[model samples]
Target: MDFTQAVEIAKHIYWIGMYLENDPFQCHPYFIENGDESILIDPGSMLEFEAVVRKVNTISSMKNIKYIILHHQDPDLAAAVPEMEKLIDRSDLLVITHSRMVPLVKHYLIRSDYYEIDKHGHQLVSGDLHLQFVTTPYCHSPGAFVTYEPFTKTLFSGDIFGGIEESWEFFAGKDYFEKAKPFHAEYMPSRDIFNYALTKIEKLELEMIAPQHGSIIQKEKIAGLIEKMKALECGLYIEKEYKDRLIHTIEELKEKDLALRASMQEIKEKEELLFQKAKMADMGEMIANIAHQWRQPLALNNTLISILKEKNQQEALRSTELAEKLQEMENNIQYMSKTIDDFMHFFHPKKEKNLFLISEVVRHTLEITDPMLKKAGVSLTFEISSEEAVEGYMNEYMQVVISILHNAKDTLLHRKTKDPDISLRLYENGKDVVLDIGDNAGGVQQENIHRIFDPYFTTKHKSLGTGLGLYISKMIIEKNMDGTLSISNTQDGALFRITLPRQSKTGKTDATQPDH
Candidate 1:
């Protein structure tokens, strides 16, 4: 088909209205030649329609238009129908629309033979041309239809595919995609419905889409446009490509992961060191307890020895009696050595699972922390409610208690209250054993309360804290032992509650603390 042909038909049609110039609403009214007839699609505004009619009349004197198709009942397109009806004497078919749109079309332009297409996939024939009407409702208007010319492979898509712009070029150029994006965003806000319409039209093998408003879309860009419409149907935004941006995001994520891993390793090392330090501290406390235990015996032994020395000096002691005193002194020294040996064994790092008393763990923890509590001037209290043994990893449970008590002691020290106190309460609530540690220091800061257990988040002076104490304790109790650790603010200070399943339910206990 020649580009400047007045009337040509092979498998294509030509537009014969004013060039759109740049306005999407303003389109050149043109005629698409079929065989002996011409289909005038959206015959522009009334004035543009008259200009087209005059040009057609001047060219061939074929003023007898067979059919006037209206895709939508808009006045801009259908306004010229009434004017054309007066000019043509032949029985021109008025293919208005379905019954729903008849009244709307009648309100604007009257006096015509109206044919109603009210079904999906309806066809209308004129000589050698086949026009198929596909219902495209909810595209700017109800009862909107897009006409497909099968032989020419051209789809006369109305407002559905077109957009509002003021470009007057004949076809969508390289910049068409960019230009159409904003138009669809504004006019076609219902992407869901628009996608449905696109799907319906996808069945047809269309070569050209001459929308009523915008530029005609040619073969090269039609498929690209359809793909874009499909993307819109799936609720996707077309993103700009930036390799550097993607690389930066990946690098940042990698850096964060590396930092997290490093921080976690550091926390693990600190926890191991702390446990070692606690063990040493507990040994020191056990030695003190041993000294307290042997005080009376040692004093009696000293008294007996002094008497034996005086008797020997006075030359009045029997050999057997002297041997007996020596024997008694030897027994006391052996007993003291045995007591020290037992204390050392209790503090030794042993990997074993056994049922143990919760009170013992509490006592052991308090003994280890006694010096620190005294140094901080924080009085300590313990309330163990379960006389019946509740079991768990002895060392881990003790460590958890110690960590909480340590935090409490620090809090009290920081507040510098006159009557600084730390309290440990252990009790069984139903099937679970619970431990509550609280202090008389002011509770955690309101904003920092939730983040206290988060790794590396601390309110203490930076050098004074590693910030992993509570976090590591939580990991040990909750993740390793299937227990729960929570923190809440009390009137006087922050309280930490740990709940561990009792031995009766768990059936086994771990004596050795598990690394988490």
Candidate 2:
């Protein structure tokens, strides 16, 4: 069936493209009429060119078709160029496209005048209709663009927003974005590339979106589609590691489920003993940690006092020297105060759920731990690939980082291996934001790996071991925050990866904002 139709999208604009009965998405070709001039957009393949030309003839004369606007150089869009040239029957017919796409279009239709779009895109005026070409590079094509007609409040979007559906309606009812999500996720490169293009497109007062494939998006659904595009983690953003990480996480969760089931009865029976032991351990551990952290600063303060006393006794303290020493003391006091504040923050109970950038909190945790790591000759490195927010208790999250870090630091000291190094990396894997903390010391023993997170399981000396740290950290991450915390041995050392579901970058104001 020729089944060709002339569908009017705006006042002088028409979708005079032939419908593809066999093609699943039913690619649409549009026609824009401008007084004595006309524009043909994506005239379809050679097989459909004659049918499309015939369709256009029924509505507008072929002689008025002045230009063929190409958003990209895809064969589906430009395959008809050679055949359509025979149809145009005029040498003055100009092809509009980006310069990079010129060679491919020339290969199809030779000896044609080309109107190239610059980096900022091109503007083409057709009678009463003013068309603005907006560059949408990597919107599934290297040199793709969306034609925006301000007068009609319409956008001739080429594959930027579309979906595969059964029916071939000219305009989709309203569920366009929802239906189109899967297609975009598969086709579009990433949200980063779409962000700038979407910003430009959203600024326009658009009434309708006529895409080359699938149905059109119109009315209130325009904003919804734009918003969806803004946050979509598409093709380029999907990590190959995500699958393995997810599979491993599922196994860990199953094991934990079984362990928790078996341990709950024992935990309940020893509730009072558990509480007292936890309290004592936490108090002793942190207080000893405070001493470990404050040793250098305390020694430095004492040395400064001794120098000042000696200088005063000799009457050799100059004004400048006194100022310099006092500044040094002030800096030491500030650092000591900051260390206390960070540790305090770790212990402070979170008041409410809120969005927090875990990277910043992790950085602060590193700062509090840096002193001890340096003192123990353990070098620490932090790399944040992508920082995004997660909805949860920030203080609790900080404690988790601290707990894991302390474990790594202690292991490094315990092993007493030369040139100890800890590598902390924070990245996102499409579905979750992952924080992977690995070390250079020997990895976990295969035997002890399974029991690492168990409550009251200790492998350290009685003076230094609390075993409750990992248990408490696991509770804070999995039970309280809906995230996964797993540890495994790597080639160099042990790797502890915490996977948290990504949340809005600008966290919600459900809780009071913490003082900076």
Candidate 3:
């Protein structure tokens, strides 16, 4: 496991990472010794330049290192590129990387010409080695990519699959994802983008994963680790963390609400009270949403604990196995904790406006409501005709969408509608972005249509319905977000439409309104 000198991983592949003991963030640079056609993949920064060169010298001469693969433009993995060029000292020594990375990587002031993978069919044949470049865009970096060696079936994944390990191990163990999760949650942009990258990696005939950071993963653990990474929530897709921040903000808002209540004479104070009440009413729905999110993780935790108990009874579990299961259970418990945190923040009051895609709002809303809809035997479909963004409090926008879907789900379940269906459509119309949510649980009665958005108006039994939902939703769309929420009857169902002014180039919504 010692990485003091170059260690041969696969035939000609060597781990030349300058390992600093007890360092939490480890950068791994690999060397492929293919004689005079040698390649160095992600040589570490200037701090480790001398030591890394010393290790590379032991494997092959600097002049023979013909290619240096700069996976992405990150300084730790790429800053030493110019210095390396001085050492290799060859005019023909090409820098291998994706085309999308060329502009940024060039800022490193690297003089060697790039062997752009995208331009050259993503393949390279050096001596006996056949190398392939796999583009993994937006997996943390827009130009992010990985390298694959056909002969060794080994991947040099830049930042993907990397971890921040407090207790460093040369090879990934069974509890590897536990170390990987925190890093992914902090770095990866979103589950969708990361999963997209993972789909490509899954198709590869991979025998090993050598990341820029953390331990190398062998074939035995590749599938399980990839599966875990796919499920990881990170960056802007960290809804749970977002909600936690919202709740923390809400606690401060609640203190202001108390002051507003004491001065009820002001018209704005009355409006604030109504908004606060509506937010409080949403707490119940948020708790239900949390339950849906927690279902899988809680089930996994139970299964893990049960297996440990059963193994103990049979006296078949080794201490190593016990420790691994414990770590898994801890991870599951942490995930559930985040869900609970999200639930507690269901009533966040809008404080600031920002630009966000309507598509992202719809996606996050479905994440909260899909389980409940499926449990009631309701089928939901969402279609996007445009990717228009709006400037607003995104969380409030998400709340409005969630409220509409909840209302649809409840109505479908209440009326015992056979083969219940809900459809969501998002599109750009003129200067506005429109979202239509329709459900086939029958149309609302004509007499009740106008009164539906009235505060404290409900048709359902006292315990099941809170009249505040639609009222708050209407308020959020019209008053808070400068949009409109309208309801109309379709041939077989009720359709709710939300129309918000599109984000303009000036960081504000367009003043022009959509035709009703």
TM-score against truth, every candidate: 0.42, 0.46, 0.47
Instruction: Single out the weakest 10-residue window by summed lDDT for candidate 3.
Output: 507-516
lDDT of each: 0.69, 0.78, 0.85
Q: Whose TM-score is higher: candidate 1's or candidate 2's? A: 2
After superposing candidate 1, which stretches have Cα over 4 Å from the reference?
Answer: 1-12, 20-24, 28-30, 34-37, 58-62, 119-121, 232-516
Error of 2 at 339 (Å): 39
Q: How far is candidate 2 from the true structure (C-alpha RMSD, Å)?
A: 18.9
Backbone clash pairs for candidate 2 read none
> Which RMSD values do the candidates have, in order?
13.3, 18.9, 28.5
Candidate ranking (lDDT, best to worst): 3, 2, 1
lDDT of 2 by residue, 373-423 (tens): 777787777776666898899987877787787788888888887898888
Q: How many residue pairs clash in each candidate?
A: 10, 0, 0
Output the lDDT of residue 287, model 3.
69
**Cα shift from native, residue 408, model 2 (Å):** 50
Give, for candidate 1, the lowest lDDT window spanning 10 residues. 507-516
